[model samples]
Target: MTERQQQRSPSSGAGAAPAPPPGDADAESGPTVLGFAPDTAEDDETVEPVADGTAARVAVGSDRLAYVRRPDLVGGLLLLLAGVADAASVWLPWDRDGDVSGLSLVVRAVDAAPEGIAELGRTGLWQPAAVAAGGVVLLVLGLLLLRPARGHRVSGVLALGVALAVAAAVVGRLVDVGWDARSFGPGAWCAVAVAGLGALGALKAVLTAPRVTTVPAERLLVG
Candidate 1:
């Protein structure tokens, strides 16, 4: 065979297939064992990473109780004292005439009437009992506020409402019998002062209570 012809022979590799383009190399090659591709769903829903130290600071479950403040402590004590004093006032002299006590009023009404319990409202003597009950409710709410909890604001509000209601009842009694100091017995004066002070303490507690929030653990740590 001629030299040129020999060089051009197909068996002699005169012409070989052109190399595959870089983009098509994979297709030409057999199936490749690719490295792991992370889940796209997780990638799409990615959260910003938090620091390890910050993650450790997050509180959980009941451990997330709100921080108590100085005002809460002080106000709670005041309300407790006011509650005790107000409740005790029910046994003291309520009127100038006959020195009728709250308990005495109930007893006399029961002794004189067939429906003594029902007569309480009609004679307006139920005010003292109602005030006493209100004082008790204030005491409970005050006790709750004394502890660190998420319900501080709610307790404070309840306390304030009860205190205000008691104060209003005391004022109503004073108005009914004329506001003269001589018209008030020790019990009446005590009720008035205790109600006023209880209301003020409740107001302070409500205003100073911290707002409680529920957030993700990560967010709590970040904050």
Candidate 2:
């Protein structure tokens, strides 16, 4: 061969590099950014995941948990009724004052001179006010009991205190005003009944534990 041809021979420095081995693709590809595996053009198949319906079940279970259950519902409804009855008691005639209803008591108290907490108490409408306040609180508590995740223990305890206060207020009023009770109106009886019912509801709420969320194992796993 001539000198120029000899220079281009296979053993010469200018000879093209030997072809790389076929199985060493890993060596040919460098590490990707963010430590991700490098994507290869050969990976064109789309993987269709199996539809297990687990996610749907999990969602349903969570949604159900948002509402109060049957036992709580009944109790809550009773409490609501109790609150309404007691509140109405404040409007109806509790005792006979020349055939006047207790509803007039507030107006009369506002106009009367200070009379301390003895006969009618310093605040003439203390008992009625208590009944009204307690009833309102009970009503709100009852409604709260109908919802989920309200910390039932705390709400129940609060309701219990309110119920007891109302009961005491009603009893004290009866004792104070009973001597003059020529004719007790339906309001008086209604107040007592509602207070009793409210107390029961409060006690029930205090004693009961909240329901735990239940979901299928598969749903939990999916979630």
Candidate 3:
């Protein structure tokens, strides 16, 4: 053989050897060498997820919380009534000189009325003035009560003041009649009754107004 042929021959140990052994794919093609082996793609296909209505509802509920809406309807009406009662008492024809003779039927009767807190007695501008001031105070307190986050102490003080005023007015009338036992017997009782009823009404208003803090939204929004 020629020298070139000899150099190229497989027998020549120095020549490049056969290409490397066939890889995994070629080996699989040659024989059924299957044993237990994980089929990752098949495993992935088996894990199918589905939409769950109950689970979705639970998730949505978990994200949200309950809240109590402030009471606009009741508070609004109360505020309006208070305003009208205050305004009419101040503007209406309520003079003292009308008749001191009918003190029992007119003065004592009207004074004892629940709305008598705003009534301006014949005692002139001073009594009316005091009544007007009390009315203004009551209006402010009502406004404060309407607010969701007002202090309880504030409401309590307001209620106590109103109650005391009403009580004092009634008690004073009793004293006026009792001291003059011969003249104003029943008229004193009339004064006491009027003052007592007014005290009760004012007490009710201040005590029952919404004062509880029920939710996070209330604290966050009502500052």
Question: Which scores higher on TM-score, 1 or 3?
Answer: 1
lDDT of 2 by residue, 165-191 (tens): 878877777677654544557676677
Ranking by lDDT: 2, 1, 3
lDDT (10s digit) by residue, model 3, range 1-223 = 7988767757556666766567955755543426444453332122333364321111111123533334333433443344344444444433232323322234444555554543434332233333334445555555655554433345546645754664464444435446453453232333333334334444554465444443432211110
Q: List the residue pairs that clash in candidate 3.
A: 96-122, 112-194
Residue 171 displacement in candidate 1 (angstroms): 1.8
In candidate 2, list every pair of residues with a backbone clash: 116-121, 116-122, 117-121, 117-122
Q: After superposition, how far is residue 193 of candidate 1 from its true place, in Å?
A: 2.5
- Extract clashing residue pairs from model 1: none
lDDT of 1 by residue, 100-173 (tens): 87667546645546667567656666667667777778777778768765435677677778887888778768
lDDT of each: 0.67, 0.67, 0.42
Stretches of model 1 off by over 4 angstroms after superposition: 1-71, 106-121, 209-223
Question: Candidate 3 local accuracy as lDDT?
Answer: 0.42
User: Please, what is the TM-score per model?
Assistant: 0.57, 0.57, 0.35
- Cα deviation at 164, candidate 3, in Å, is 3.0
